[model samples]
Target: MNLAESLGDCEFQSVNTAYDENMPVDRKVLVDNATLSGVERLIGESRVRNLGNVDNDILCLEKLLTAILFSDALMAIDDYKEEYRSKRSRQFSFIKFLKLDHVSYADLSGKAADFARSMTFSFDGSKPAGDVVSFFEALRIDPQLRWDVFVSSEYLTMSLLVRDTRDVGYENSIDGVFRNESANADVVLAGIKFDAPVSMEHHAEISSIKDLVDAFASNNPNFRGSSSGSLLARCIFGYGWAAERSYFYNAVAAQNNASVFLAPLRDAFCEGCCRLESRSQVESLLAALKSKSQATMAKIVESSGQAKFALKLPFFSAYLISICDNPRQCIEHALELRNRSEFRDCRSILHNLDFLSVGERSAELNRILGLLEQSCDSLLRKYGVATANGLQVSLSLGLAGISAGTSIKLDRLFPFYRNRPFSRLFRNIAQDMVNVERLGGLYEKLCASVKEHQDAGYPSRTSVTPKFMERRENEYGRPAKL
Candidate 1:
């Protein structure tokens, strides 16, 4: 009843795929082209290698099924709960739908059928054929195939991991891999809180694995502190957003703290071509974040990690600024600033500034913050910063943003550092400073609060933005306040 036995050579039936012709006009061209290309690649790769590993082939097939299920579930969520629709949100819902421990093989078979029937493929202009049709047919006719095979030791472990992860948060169930009697205290600790019921029953100390993962996930923006299933899905599918992968790997490195079962899990789940690249970038950012002095932040802002991790990676820079012994305060601070009214007016402008970091011209940047702060001197006192480090970090971040050409991001780390309205105003003033000689007048103008700029009808500058931000403008994507 093993996977290899279940997948023994079997005949496959071919079927026609029917696609919806009336897709949204704007998306039709791109979606169709991408789908066609994807199918060709999926089938071509599987068919060519006579020596293809059956287990590997099964994994690839699982990815394809997961993709179809993911897409279908997302559409359902969009229709049912429009407000709670995001790639991450949909993914969360999809895991709930899976109910991995309860889902039957028959359900998987039905899903496979639906996916196969929906996809139409063609080679050299021949009649269109669906890849899933052939794939499922092979499984359908295999005499050795049985639903019970999934419960075999290896798959049962994976199932338990997914099932427990979906029900309890990741921190609670992380050590499920070491749930067996033979697993040591470190392995048990990796999966459960030291004070958790099971951990207490065994009288284990706070596991280092737990500390490492908690810290890494807390600081890494991609994992978003607690929403971990997306990374789990990525580990299965072989590719994921760079941020998610980065944070997930950081958690993995922490598991390396417990050298027992972690290495094997890392090899199995974290195996993709991008592994080395992502690990390097993640480590670099972590090192920068961990440094006690501003030297780390300054160095990162001056290098590749600055744009990729600090600016482009969502919330990561804020996490680094907020790094402390306890992250609850930092998380709360980020959430509060995100929702504050002061930054509400120029949120998009603030976002634009994150992507526009100017590396070398720091003196000009300070001038920008100084000019903008001049107008908001009264509010600065009233804003009431919580800590000295918070204020210092915010000010440094403001300078960092100016050097990069945007300072709105400082709001996330230091709520009172740079007034958003003033940030927009200062950026306008900087943009208007065309002549070196006229810089004096521009600084004088920027010194006025943002209200003065608005009253005087100063023009705001618009910069090109990333595509992901553009997608955020869709009906379901309300700009994040937190």
Candidate 2:
């Protein structure tokens, strides 16, 4: 954020001159992206030319806060690395001016100062690497804050980034700003972590700040201890839910000295080739694999690439049988595809639990039957025949979401459209096709039309076929047609 904006937001005096005038500005840091660069050019030139240096002031505050943040991260790393490289302890320094009228560290005392002291522990004896962020994140997981203690309403908002192993406390106040405790610098940043690691049985836990804290403190050891760092990192790599997981990804990689953080991403660069019929399709899939739930997709990939391919044999066969409809082959495919675990949802199985023995056969039948029932319901619902009232409306929605020009039930279509309602058509043809007797030709005709239309593009989509309607007044044995 620029100066004027932060001042207006924090309700503080807008301008204060720092004599650090000529230290070749950290060009890369200042000009992060085009937007930040623009802010710099506009603000810097303004301050130099004395045209109301608004942006410069906010940016400076942001810079200072970023310093603090760097200090925190470096300290955490130092704790983990234990390299005693720098002698200066990265303690947060207060702005000389936020010192007016007991504003600086002086204004803070008694309960408030004690509370703040009690709030954060200055790097517990253990390495902060994963533990410190977890502590701050524990503070952040309060799904919400009822900050009656805060002087300004702006402090009300805060977010926590928690991975099983790595985490951080981020404030999204008036402007985009994040602070690393040790650096005492303000970074107008977006995120911290970037890529997640690949591992089995990894899951991210997203909950309210209160819930997060509760989980960390109560029962969810993964959120509290350093042990959680790797687990949380793995989950963050998967689908870390709180805020955006991407923000914490890079930050965690840069700071936390844990088990190789970006090993999966590097490994992918080394060995991420996926062979598929469509190269473009595979590339796109691989791209998605980066952000997808890695563990779940891994299961699918493992099954797909297996030597025997037994795990997915059932689904493959079922898919082929759906298109071909060769009953014998479909049965064989269905048998191979079926898994008892897959049919635990079938109400039929739940009902006949005692009589029908549980096995692949039962699961297979239930799977097909379950699919059939669902498909029928889906088709019926699509055609607006979901309810009894809709049933009489006839089939306006056809085979593949198409609509016949006109619709009529079976009895109406046969003799009506052909000028020979089924009442008459049946009398003439019932003697011929024995199959039609068992399932009347009119019924047979309906089924045939349904199948044909399903395949065709009006009632057939690609083809135009006349829809049937009921007719009367002239036919052999026309049974007093209505």
Candidate 3:
């Protein structure tokens, strides 16, 4: 049948040929041409267009064909037949064509047919070349692509490069795609190289900080005991959950020298404290504190407390509670002591914890709090804090009490001191009482500072309101006194 007649029903109809013994036809050529024609027709129907750039089109088409063939081969694999059947069905409309340079349609179709034939025949148990085998094997084993047929265009392009090239290591492949100048520095540093085309859904999943950490931890083998681990440490230290970063650093430190992370840890701690506008940020600072030595924690606290924009008292309380031998026990002991005196000062600490509790209780906030709580619990247990029954005490109460006490002390001693340095304020609070120490030396300093500040005839910075209209008038030639 003619091409039009063969495809008249919108399905691939078998072409029948009449053969003459006297004049033998090249049946293979005819069949190939017929298949090419069918593909062209489909491409046309799908509205696949190419730009007028031949070189770019050729390159893109080669990658697209390779990806399509690889997907088909994977579906044909006996081991994954059942698993991929539904996936294949779902991917019927998944192949999207970006505008490629205009190349000869015949040349592109011929190349695609050749690729399809090569891929189809290669599944006969014959060992392929090392590069091709590794290229396919890496993709074949990717758990992320197992149940999805959707492949990212970039991944396909990378796969084609790997298949054609030799000596392309994982890092090299990653570097080639995500170059140093690329905006996705986090992905590169975290070693998140995609061997296979992952679905957009999976791409979105790994885009998150938490998932990125998990991916970094689970996927990159080169990160373990390698200098790359430190690079990853630096990268993660800039973004995501501080606790996760600390945990990763601790793990890397375990393998490498702990001293390696000390400098970075100090820097990260100070930077983290400066940006502590949320409970999660506070929790991250606490995690950093928990990971380091008592001396390191003290140094960080002291240095940060001396800054003009010192850590908030409530957050500082959380930090102190985190560093204590047993935060829960410390609070319980303090509460017991308070009870004996018939005076309850733990209210401020509780109030502080309540303030630190997630403001909106959103899912993301809940997740952050959950991770922070777990990290805090682990830190508390590390300090030998357990219940009488040998179970671990929940840190919720300890954290609350610490926060409350810190807030109360700040309110009482440094009521007018907006920038109440954590170090200064914390020192004036009795460790045993978990409340303000009226006789402490720091208390006298705070009293004098408050009195001096009051006498300076300066308005409270909080109470100062900008005169917008007056400023506008001054800017545009001040209005007459009238």
Candidate 4:
């Protein structure tokens, strides 16, 4: 008979099912001898039920009965296994109730065993609120069903399952089964090479940055000759202390063949160090620098990007010389050396130094400033300096005021100066500066006010007097001063 007909003929009688005390008792008791026999008959029939022909109520009854019977079968298989283990029973009660012969029982046992095991393992003494195990069992039973869903969902399920079973002994078995059934099994399995644990013997041998870089390059050959490789190399070198000065030098020198990669390597090293901002790292770098000979130190300072890294930090230049035996000699030596003839590089270093000295100044600051200034002067002399993008560089004279002529000259020379406004505003400033008479009168007024303040007998400078007066009278007469 069809599933609906069989379900329609069944009579369900309330029967109490034994459950662990810890298990929830919210489930309705809907299964009995008559209902179980009806389900068995429905399973035995191979005929497919036509939902269009079947009544909706009978179809619903069929679905409800099927679900209840499936859940009961899952729980019974788990109980039978436990009972068989303890008592060595020759026959399971559910097996006899279903009237399954040897072959049928073996087939049913194999089909339902995994779900039973997973439910028992996951829930332990209590039943789970939902049958998560059955859902996974459906996926295992039907390959086409897994293919219909998004691949990422499968990966998410695998991750969640792994996390849930991490401390359990059966995680590996579950992981192996899921991976074997996954659509991307080849890709997932290939990643195992990278995830393999590093051997202690090999790990112990990575005593220097060079050793670490070599090991990485050996394993990830595809990443070689790429910017990513350079970045990785820089991180290795920058984040750790070297075993010796030679080791550090050799690591830097090895990348000379791909000099184009050096810029990013240097930049990343500097950035990594700055981001860490660790006092211990700073001290380590300083100690490394101090141990080297003057010639070796100069190579590192001038050629290997260490000088730029050190200058990026606040007051590090001052700090470096502070710990030196001869501060004056060190300053003089640094000043005498010539930097690489790159205008942009010189400009960047000078800007960093200026930013560091803001809000405070010292003799050391002046000395460092002189060293960079001398390098810049030397660069300009050698290259015959030109305006950066046709704009003049603006100069700040502290006591001496910025004149209109100076502004015009700066606009002409350093058109690319950061302070230069957009084209429209720049044109307005240039036009205003050209009106020399107006600007001159304003300047004269400013000078007159300054002279008046200096001549006043008040203890402090005051722009306003204590009493108000008519403009004409105030201009001509000496008003009451504060």
Top candidate on TM-score is 1
Instruction: Tell me which residue pairs clash in candidate 3.
Output: 51-102, 53-102, 348-404, 348-405, 349-400, 349-403, 349-404, 349-405
Model 1 pairs whose backbones collide: 175-191, 356-404, 357-404, 358-403, 358-404, 358-405
lDDT of 3 by residue, 60-165 (tens): 2222222221121111111113443344334323322122123433333333233222221111111222112322322221101100011221010011122222
TM-score of 4: 0.16
Give stretches of model 2 more than 4 Å off. Answer: 1-30, 34-41, 44-482
lDDT of each: 0.22, 0.20, 0.22, 0.22
Output the TM-score of candidate 2.
Answer: 0.14
Candidate 3 or 2, higher lDDT: 3
Q: Model 2 over residues 1-482: C-alpha lDDT tens digits?
A: 32223224332221111111222211111101212221232222212222122122223322222222212121221121123112212221121111113322132222222222221211111111221233222222211111111122111111122232121211121011111111111221221322222111111342222333343345322222222112222222222211121122222321222111111111111111111122344334333423442111111112111110000001121132234333223223333322222222222221221122223233333333233233223322322211221121110000111111222211111111222100000000011111112222222222221111122221101101111111111221111100
Q: Tens digits of per-residue lDDT for model 4 on 244-347?
A: 11122222222221000111112222222222333344334434433432211111122211122121111111221233333223223333322222322333
* TM-score ranking from best candidate downward: 1, 4, 3, 2
Residue pairs of candidate 4 with colliding backbone atoms? 390-415, 391-413, 391-414, 391-415, 392-413, 392-414, 392-415
Poorest 10 consecutive residues by lDDT, candidate 1: 424-433
Measured on C-alpha atoms, candidate 3 has an lDDT of 0.22
